[model samples]
Target chain A: MLTKRIIPCLDIKNGRTVKGVNFVDLRDAGDPVELAAIYAAEGADELVFLDITATVEKRKTLIELVKRVAAEINIPFTVGGGISSIADVSALLNAGADKISINSSAVMRPELVSELAGEFGSQCVVVAIDSRFVEGEHIVHVSGGRIATERRTLLWAKEVEERGAGEILLTSMDHDGTKAGFANELTAKVSGSVSIPVIASGGAGNQEHFLDSFTIGLADAALAASIFHFKEVSIPDLKNYLKGYNIPVRIEK
Target chain B: MSVVIVDYNAGNVQSVTYALERLGVSPVLSADPEVIRSADRVIFPGVGEASTAMRFLKERKLDEVIKDLKQPVFGVCLGLQLMCAHSEENNTDCLGIFDVQVKKFEPTLKVPQMGWNNLEHTTGPLFKGIEADSYVYYVHSYYAETSEYTIATTDYVNTFSAALNKDNFYALQAHPEKSGKVGERILQNFLDIK
Candidate 1:
């Protein structure tokens, strides 16, 4: 009875959790370490810190931030963005991050997945696939959705799994920022196709969206950034709603 | 009392070190047999392939070191899996501390039982403060079936050993480092163990 996971993805830019911090109560909540503690205390199943930059120096800041955030929270923490090599992944893991997510780097070098999973474990490697609907086909997009590849979303999902990725963080570019809902059609297709766990990311406007991700999308986990940062949907409140719906979720008391 | 985290190049050692540090315990990460033998407590935390990791342990003779250590040792995730008799993972032979077999979870639901699950039928000092149905995080495909060493049980496609205890060795199938407050309480319990 492994419960479905609810993850709050913290978009970190220049070491701060960027975007949608308008909650009056957390007016001074720019620090990721502070935000992570609050989310972990409020019953977040896991936390993901995505360093939204490609700068080499920003990678250092991201690692430092991971150390600080990890120190304050006990739940599983995932650090992603700009992770390209075994050195980068090992550094983050050494700094206390539980899992490392590789996006564009993984797409550029699919072999990196097997190499990292070889050194570390598949359980510590998360391959995040950012996909967009392109002319009736879901195309894999990389470089934070700025670069589109010819690879099909479902095909790339299978590729990463074959490369020994433990989980897939599938993000729908069209559904992102729209809050309309997650791309359940694509998510369900990928989740059904892969043997590993699938984390449905983006377009999570409400608790119902999360429910859809689980039921319709068949996702093992759901990840959202704005819904959590803006305090529109607290982790405890969301978990409570999901619990009543009979979706198995960890309720931290 | 000194604490040493047995390091065999398996991942998740740093997370466990941080968890121990939060409890005001500084641990030394070492692969030296003497260092591990002399430590007052040892936390064998790991997350990796069983055969690959056991090979590294055997390479450094840590396999024998771990088996012979008389100090209180706590194994987490892959650490627990490696303590069992043998694992279906690569047909790997393990340390045999728990005298049980680790089998791959049947893909009745999901291959990897990822995320939190409740602990039930729990006993022993490892679960002293934790209540029934209290959740802990788990992320693995292989699990040891409930056995004589099983101190805690959980259901995930089947009843499996969540925690096991044999003499001075205690192990958990879940990653307590990532299991939050209840996990910290469990780590504290291990630190307080004589």
Candidate 2:
């Protein structure tokens, strides 16, 4: 049976894990390698490390941080943010990262997704889409959910899938940081539209919210930040809650 | 000593490298004939269109080098397809190491067969201790038609060769690296085979 994944996303900046509200106003979380090991031990199926800084100085540091984390952690990790070319994807994958997530760069050059998928296997490629509800329509946003694209979320998701994205990480900008719950409706819509696995991101405050994302949204995985980072909800506790709810999860020995 | 993973422009080499590392072996990714011949073992993993992959191998003259390798060799997914005499995918010619042809699975059974499927009829050192009917990960539309080379079989819509073995040459239609513990065990078994 396929296990539903529980992932804790960490934003790395200046070689440290940081968290922010709405992708701004960052505060220190912890060392990425330490946080990653904690999550893996707690039964997280995987981890995603996004380099939040856009400047050149921090980019080099972030790549080095990715190398360190990849070296230490045994579980699958995905590195994203500012990934522009096949070389970037290769660098992360070579560093022991299991997958690479592309956002702004992917939207700008959709062909890169296909090219990377061709070179590496599709399972190594993940496309992260930041979407916000604009006038009752889900519009795609890039550059950390700041710039809105003309493309609709669902349409772009279909395009990415056809381009050979192994999985879709759909983050609802509208619900991000709200802690109200996941955008179940949007996740369900995208999951239904794409043949590949869809991972629901944003708006998780509690264990029940995770369940809602799995049951209502039909998401294959649920990713969150502060809730897991702040220890407001431990991954084992959350998995226990989900197991009580009968959601399939891999229990660690 | 580093294991050599042939880079013939096929996919899944990264996963194989990671899997080997998990089993405490570091592999060197290479396409050069000398590098491959000098390594402890050679892994020929593949993904993507069979015809295009074969063309890449032929262009690099890796086709002949791979056929003459004296060390143990392993193939996965499209790698298995290419080892066969022919493939239904793009009607391409292959290495013909094993007298078998890769055929496309029935369209009605979901073209890709993308998920966990059970392995049956297991018989090989590669599957040594792996329980029968254990699920291994798979993703592809074409499969190797049953032949004397086949050592294991699986069923999606119908039974087909899940694994093939002939002397030092071994190929798996499913990805053992991505298949979790069962996959890791299979890989360990492959490494243990002397």
Candidate 3:
């Protein structure tokens, strides 16, 4: 059976982990490679490294960091943030990234999604959509959800899938840091509308939130940042908890 | 032992190379016929479209080289699909190393079944120390049907060949490089194949 995925997303700035990760075993918490290895050992289904780095010159740092992580970590990881062009994606994949996720770039030039899916195959192209429930409808937001776009959340999701994106990473801006719950209504609607797998992101405070995301949200995967980083929920315990609910999760032996 | 990962336009060969490095073997990513032919073990790893990959392999004449390899040759993901006789992906004909056909997954589930799934009914040297229900990472829309060559199987939309073994050629529908410790053991088993 295809197990529902449990992903731990790490924010990267200047090649170092932006949020302070509280791992007792980690000597250097800022090292993304070590944190990634630790997560893989603890049974993370996959890892996502969102490069929050600002400058283009320092982007090389992320590439080097990707290489180190790929060499050390055994599981698949996706590299995102500030990736707009084919060259940027080429460099990251060459540096050993299994997949690459695009956001604002795809919204700016939607053809980049098709181009990437054509060049690298859709299996490696993940389109991340940040949306927020505004007024009466869910609106698409870009530039790390700071700016709103003209596109509706559901239409954009369909468009990216039509453009050959293999997966969709849907993050609810309204629920991101709230710790209340996932945007289950939006997630369920998008997941139902698209044939590609949908990964529900944001608003995970406890193990029950993840369960809600998979069950109510209809997400194929659930991604959380602060919870996994702060050790609020160990992956094994989370998987075990999910298993008790009959959610098919991969438990590492 | 010399290990070579057949290189063409396939995506993400670096991960497979790194996995071998973790197993203490420096693998050469080469499209050269002589280099691949001379290697003690040849890993045919691939990611991307079937027809495009087939085009690149034919242009470089690696297809014939791969078809004739006598050493223990392992194929991963798209590599496994391309080894089959035909692929429903792009309606392309593959190097007929394995007697199976690749078909697209039905839309009842996600097109590209991406995530970890455990291997069942696994038997053969490649699964030596690996436990039953050991999960491996997979990301592909097409899968090769289970056949006489299937050594292991996994259930997704339906039962499909998780791993296939026929003579010196072995293939896995999953990415062993990205499958963590269970994947490490599978790669190590391939290395230990004398």
Question: Which pairs of residues clash in candidate 1, taking residues 3 or more apart in a chain or in different chains?
Answer: A1-B155, A1-B156
Question: Which ranges in model 2 have alpha carbons more than 4 Å from their true place?
Answer: A19-29, A41-43, A69-75, A94-96, A109-123, A231-253, B11-15, B18-22, B34-39, B68-70, B98-123, B128-162, B173-183
- Top-down lDDT ranking: 3, 1, 2
User: How is the predicted docking of candidate 3 categorized under the CAPRI scheme?
Assistant: high
Compared with the real two-chain complex, what DockQ does model 2 have? 0.17
Candidate 3's residue-wise lDDT over A1-253, tens digit each?
8999999999999999996688888899889998998899999999999999889999999999999999999999999999999999999999999899999999999999999998888988999999988889899999989999999999999999999999999999999999998999999999999999999998999999999999999999999999999999899999999999999999976
Question: How many clashes show up per model?
Answer: 2, 0, 0
For model 1, residues B77-158, the per-residue Cα lDDT tens digits are 9999999999999999999999899999888877778889999998988888898898999999999988989999999889
Candidate 2: Cα lDDT at B21: 88
Question: Which structure among the candidates has the greatest DockQ?
Answer: 3
- Best by the lDDT measure: 3
Two-chain complex of model 3, DockQ on C-alpha atoms against the true structure: 0.92
What is the C-alpha lDDT profile of model 2 across B50-115, one tens digit per residue?
889999999999999988887788888888899999998889999988999889877554345654
Tens-digit lDDT track of model 3 for B145-186: 999999999998999999999999999999999999999999
| Order of models, best DockQ first | 3, 1, 2
True contacts kept of each: 0.81, 0.04, 0.96
TM-score for each candidate, following the candidate numbering: 0.96, 0.80, 0.99
Docking quality tier of candidate 2? incorrect
Worst 10 residues of 3 chain A by lDDT: A17-26
What is candidate 2's lDDT per residue for A138-210, written digit by digit as tens?
9999988999999899999999999989889999999999999999999999988887788999999998999
